[model samples]
Target chain A: MNAMTMIELGIAIIILIGTIVGFLSAIGFLRLPDVYNRAHALSKSATLGVLCVLVGTFLVFLFVEGYFSIKLFLGIFFVFLTSPVSSHVICRAAYRSHVSLAEISVRDDLKEAIIENNKETEDM
Target chain B: MAIQVLANLLIGLLWVFFQDDWSVLTFFSGYLFGLLVIFILRRFLPTKFYLFNLHAMIKLLFLFIVEIVVSSFVVIGIIIRPKMNIKPGIFSMETTLKGDIEVTLLALLITLTPGSVVVEISQDNKIFYIHTMDIPDLSNSVLQSKDRFENAIKKVTR
Candidate 1:
């Protein structure tokens, strides 16, 4: 009914949604078939989950605490920028290390490219 | 760059005056606010360098948000279901965009999108090796990724 209560309600909803998303990401990690799929689950769901939580925290600080912190904004930005890069690096390393794809995978386009590169190097 | 820094300083001072707070946090917030203002007016400014188009950036951001939410649900569905019949595969996509920044941005976008992760980039940077969780039709998947993610990034960076 009051402004403070309303703000509290909004923050609770946001945090609840974020918690659900984080739970789903963990489920995805357990249920997905392969490393690539697991990575997808971790990167997309986990990143969004954290972002939601951070945004909710930002709102809380801005509305309830009556002060803004640049640290929160920077935390959100750094997570947004770095998560994808780290995921990409992990996937790339996995691929290069020849981690087998899922059994149902239909294609291996990178295999052909790598083979072609090997042939070119051999020719040289 | 010097002018931009001076303008940001002025904005920061103004923010301190209005907020009645002289903390480092408020100063950085004001500087960020100034950068945002300049970003919005980038196109109209007389600068030699190609300023990022705010509209394109915002559009890309919106697209990213939508994609993230949609894909998160999709992945969650795949996970929660009793039967998981994912046909994952690595596909090579040829891109028109050049430069490390543009290509890297595209790869990052693809990796962030649900059901896909970029595994490799060719030596020439023309092709991206992406691993997708579902690839019922490889060509269609490649085309869809090109249209959905790559094109949006191209609009922003190119």
Candidate 2:
């Protein structure tokens, strides 16, 4: 009985942490200055949050129920692998599509590099 | 990698037999146990296809998780504040890693961390264009990121 309660408590704490992370990610998504910043929030926090939730779910199924889920483990691994890739793709696409940077952005190092490369090419 | 997978699967099957429970957890535990066994015996294993150092890979994973938690808190702190005092910028950094997989994994690690996203890769793949949320000191930030993430990745992948 005590062991079961301890397991339940552990599950609850894990789920709670996951929920808090998801909440923070949502807040970041709504409050950040631009798409890039929002993308950061969405990618990092949401991915971690989802991972935590999945971990909690995994524990629940393992401890509360007597079944183990290969699918859940696969889902967790897949999400961990793919979420960052998707975010990188989106950010690159946004940059190529000429999405404007936030007003406080102080540097465009890529622009300068591109200009230098172009100049060198012309010299050739 | 194929050999590693096969060995792990065999270990997992053995674990299930021992546990007397044909469940995923038992199998997974067995797989992990197999990995540990392999890690221990890596020095003696006469395989030419050892792709990575197991200890370094584990360290990298631990570092990544720690960075995620810390950065998440930092971002959260910034978001909940009344004034959004951010200085975002795109910066280029030179990388010593050359392989496609290494570069891609490095980029993914950077993107997944807080306050930075990989914007582009140079034609020669020698440089990475990264967009960072805060750049109080450009050189410092670059060096910190390189030390923290890039170095570990290089150890694991290269």
Candidate 3:
């Protein structure tokens, strides 16, 4: 058996936990009732999962191999930045396209705001 | 802004590559040197040096990490229940944050917190329309979270 250091064990555990988080997010995405709800699972939880995996591996390379992968750091930053923006854009587009909310949704205060904006545009 | 910071980092990373040095200390020293070099040549540069509110930036990052971890577990709890009883809905909240950067950052932070996603920002950029997965109170909860985020952002921008 190969000798394992504490750092290696920690990295392995983190990656494994990330995998589990990603799996749970996938389940949440599929099980959620509407597009808006699924976007939550995808944007935030999955991003967390990916963040954990990338940071864990980055640490392994940084500590064990003594290789500084700046690209890996960029990957983390870009993923954190882009995922939320993409998900936000998708949600905005869906709402603008007149997608109806699920029947169980308690309220949609945005509808009133959108109607008011439309009325202002008509006046202009 | 992109060219300025990216150029500095690229120079530092290049130093690491050329010397076959993977040490972070080496990279940082090189980065500092690049910063000095850039500062010396700032007169010729187009954009001014990037100003950072380091205190507020660190605070925002800390809040983001805490929110991400806590809300993710909360979401998982909602999903794990045998019966997925929820009050998924969209609500609008007005924010004091102005400018593209502050507004965008606030929206990004809100979405990254797991339970809520920003569906839209109004034309004036003062109001945000958000879709929450399991939030029960629309107005009060929004105000609470909004105050937390808005304060962090106000520090950073102004």
Candidate 4:
């Protein structure tokens, strides 16, 4: 195959990998027994998958027009920075409101912490 | 000190190459100005004697890049999917890293990686509360989260 075709193949592989990971993450969202467990699957794996796709796009851009690759990197940087924080906030909210977990859950440090924190607040 | 001056001179020359303008006086003044800034900063904030080992920093940067790309697709997929397809909730990740800066960097990495965002850091800072967009296997996700990102931070920062 030619060089361009090789690049295309690489990009396609990346996109495919990303797509599959995304699908799995979504499935994890549905299949996981509880919010905490689901969060585990969705955030970490999906992040990995999306990054693969972005790298593919970056590669394509680098080959075709080299101008915007840095900007693309910056965009990727912001996504890396923010996604985890927002997820944390959402989950904390759920826990504070007393969301139920799956039956198999053995330990819950967050619940404990929340309880301890509440007691401290009440004492104060 | 002399090495830093030489390095700055080389950087200034490289800049001139990019700009395609070779003005000796301008380069000299720019170099002086850059040195002045560094000097002022150093005066205010004393330089550490610790050697600048970049191996960890480079590794962290590489891992973070990979994470950003992956999480972007994940988030986008969640947005576009037909179903209200997300199992959103908080989970705490156990960590091995102990340094405050290291933990903060790990937290930053977690947040930057998309679908997951940091919520609360325990007072001890050994545990991180994170929210995820979906779920499949919590244990695997927890392991992967540490292996891929948090563990990498520990290796680098420590």
Using DockQ as the measure, the top candidate is: 1
List the candidate 3 regions with Cα displacement exceeding 4 Å. A1-4, B1-31, B37-52, B137-139
Candidates 1 and 3: which is better by TM-score?
Answer: 3
Q: Per-residue lDDT tens digits of candidate 3, residues B36-78?
A: 8778888898866643455777899898888777777777777
Candidate 4: residue A34 Cα off by (Å): 2.4
- Winner by DockQ between candidate 3 and candidate 2: 3
Give stretches of model 1 more than 4 Å off.
B1-52, B137-142, B148-151
lDDT of 2 at A35: 81
lDDT of each: 0.81, 0.79, 0.83, 0.65
Backbone clash pairs for candidate 3 read: none
What ranges in model 4 sit over 4 Å off? A66-68, B1-36, B39-43, B47-54, B63-100, B108-119, B124-158
Measured on C-alpha atoms, candidate 1 has an lDDT of 0.81
Better model by DockQ: candidate 1 vs candidate 4: 1
Task: Show the lowest summed lDDT stretch of 10 residues, model 1 chain A.
Answer: A28-37
TM match of model 1 to true structure = 0.82
Off by over 4 Å in 2: A117-124, B1-47, B137-139
CA RMSD for every model? 4.7, 4.8, 3.9, 7.7
